[model samples]
Target: MVNAFFLFILAGLAEIGGGYLVWLWLREARPLWYGILGGIILVLYGIIPTLQKFPNFGRTYAAYGGIFIFLAVIWGWGIDKKIPDTYDWIGVAVCMVGVSIMLWAPRH
Candidate 1:
C-alpha cells in the first residue's frame, strides 16, 4: 500500500513536472532544452507505473488518474501560485475516495 502510493507520487511528479517543462518551452518560450528534458522525463513517467506490483494494467492506470488529479492540484497551488478553492478540495477528496475503492477493494 505504502509502496504503491510512493510509486504513484513518483509517477505524478514525473508526468506533471515533465509536462510543465514542455509547456514552458512551447507556450512560455523558455528553451529547447526544456522540451528535451521534459520529453525524457515524460518517458520516465510512462515507465514508472510498470514497476508497480499490480498486474492489472487497467486498474493501475485508472487509480493513477486519481492520484494525478490530487497531485495536480498541489502542483498548481505550489508551482502555479494558484490556491485551491473549496471546490478543488472537494474534488480532490472525491478522487482520493475513488482511488481507495479502486485500488483497495477486495476481490469477489
Candidate 2:
C-alpha cells in the first residue's frame, strides 16, 4: 500500500514536471533542451504506472487521477511559489476523498 502511493506520487511528478518543462519551452520561450527532456520524461511517465502491483488499469488510472490533482497543487505552490487558496485545498481534499472511495472502498 505504501509502495502503491509512492508510485502514484512519482508518476504524478513525472507527468506534471514533464508538462511544466514543455510549457516553459514552448510558452515561455525556453531552450529546445527543455522540450526534449520534457518529451523524454513524458515517455517515461507512460511507463511508470505499469510498475504498480494493481492489475486493473481503469481503477488504477482513476485513482491516479485524484493523486495527480493533489500533487499538481503542491507542485505549483512549491515550484511556482503560488500559494493555494481555500478552494484549492478544498478541491484537493475532495479529490483525495474520491480516490479513497475508488481505490480503497470495501466491495462485495
Candidate 3:
C-alpha cells in the first residue's frame, strides 16, 4: 500500500513533466527532441513504480486513466497558463470523484 501511494505520486509528477514537454513542443518546433525524450523518460519512469506497486497491470492502468484525466486539466491550466472554464472544472471534479471511488472502494 505504501509503495503504491509513493508510485502514484511519482506518476503524477511524471505526467506533469510530460505534459509540459508536449506543451513546449507545440510552441517551439525546435524543441521536438526534448518533448520526445521527455515523453519516453516520463513513461518509463512511471512504469517501474506502477509495476512494483500493483499486482495487476490492468488495475494500475485503470487507475492511471482517471488520475491522468484530472491531472491533465490541472496541467493545462496551471502549467500552460490557460484558464479552464466552468465546464472544464466540473468535468474534472466529476472524474476525480469517480477515480477516488475506483481506487479506494473496498471489495469484499
Candidate 4:
C-alpha cells in the first residue's frame, strides 16, 4: 500500500541521512553537532518501523532491509555523486522483487 511504502522510504531516509551525518562528523571532520543530530535521527529511524501495521517484527525488518539497500544506492548516486553501473541496477531490482514477495505474498 501507499502508506507502507511511504513509511519504508521515510525510515530509510532517516537511517541513511543520520548515518551520513555521523560519517561527516567523524570521517569528514564536521562539527560535533552533526553527530548529535545524526544520533537523534537514528533514534527516529529505530522507532519509525514500529509504526508499521505488520505484526511480524522479523518479516517487517527483513522487508525493510531490501528497501534500505535500494535507498542507499540512490543516496550514493545522488548525494555522493557516484553513478551506479549496470550491476548496481540489477542488484537493486533483485532486492526490490524480494522485498515485494516477502511483504505482499499470501500467507496460510
* Tens digit per residue, CA lDDT, model 4, 27-103: 99999999999999999999999999999999999999999999999999999999999999999999999999999
Scanning candidate 2 in windows of ten residues, the lowest lDDT window is 99-108
Tell me how far the alpha carbon of residue 64 in candidate 2 is from the true structure, in angstroms, after superposition: 0.4
Candidate 1 whole-model C-alpha lDDT, 0 to 1: 0.97
Q: Local distance difference test, per candidate?
A: 0.97, 0.95, 0.72, 0.97
C-alpha TM-scores of all predictions: 0.98, 0.96, 0.70, 0.99
Give the local distance difference test score of model 2.
0.95
TM-score of 2: 0.96
Each prediction's total of clashing residue pairs, residues at least 3 apart in sequence or on different chains, is 0, 0, 0, 0
Q: In model 2, what lDDT does residue 94 have?
A: 97
Model 1 spans > 4 angstroms off? none
Q: Per-residue lDDT of 6-52 in model 2, one digit per residue for the tens?
A: 99999999999999999999999999999999999999999999999
Roughly what TM-score does model 4 have, to 2 decimal places?
0.99
Question: What lDDT tens digits, residue by residue, belong to model 3 across residues 1-108?
Answer: 666656665687686787567767877664678789778867766675555545667767677676677777777788778888999888878876876776778877
